[model samples]
Target: MNRLPYATVARCVSSLSRTGLYQGVDLRVLEAFDLDALAHFSGMQPGALCAGACVASQSSPALALTSANLRWCPACMAEGLHAALFQFSPITRCPTHNAPLIQACPHCGKTIPYRLDPAAVATPLACPTCMSPLVADLTILAHAHHIVGP
Candidate 1:
């Protein structure tokens, strides 16, 4: 699945564009947003109800937005929006043999393998039994090296 929903990609690009951070060098970081990893980037808990109206109208309760601190942005509403719809660009994964998903369970520190769905990039991948969120140490695509502006 693609990571960094298109919306966030769009927003990141727009944010960079507006802030003048969008240079050729940043494309590498942008390319890192693939359907495989993007679904986990929003930092939002799935299926949680959003309480405001500023959120994108199409967001699902499971895909509600959260502050960088991992708390809900109360001032913002959680309407049904495609998480990817907010990004200005698309996240492309490397064509190399699928990299191993190396995430650890936040609760247990257990290793979790990653898979690139190329779809469902907005959904979280949890432990098969506990459904715990897995923290990953991802390898940024080489192309992404150029996309993240200094």
Candidate 2:
């Protein structure tokens, strides 16, 4: 959506507000998506995307819910995908060490450590160690229920 009209963005904000989600998100937050800024704003590394953020615009109707430019945060998405995955919004610290974690290749199964400055977003995810489907495409319908099942 190239420069979505103010009305559209407002509608989305209104909807989110009514749902009691993203109540404090400033309108400027949605404005960042104008130039594929979700990648940068989300602080996600290149290539890899967490499951929740993994669902692309073409993958599911869930994205239709946000003005997020169809870009999802893997960490946030993981939480939505599976409650046990992670516990943080805009996760700035490494869930493991409480330090910082970077995106890695799930295929290579290597931890591509990152600093997560919390001040910077849009980090690349190519592993200097190996290749992996970092952002493995998945449909929301497939994961609409439970990633690990009760």
TM-scores for every candidate against the unseen true structure: 0.19, 0.20
Per-model tally of clashing residue pairs: 50, 6
**Cα shift from native, residue 29, model 1 (Å):** 16
**Model 1 lDDT tens row, 19-91:** 3432221221223223223334544432221221123322333223321112111111021111222222221
Runs of candidate 2 exceeding 4 Å displacement: 1-104, 116-123, 137-150
Off by over 4 Å in 1: 5-103, 117-125, 134-150
lDDT (Cα atoms) of all candidates against the true structure: 0.29, 0.33
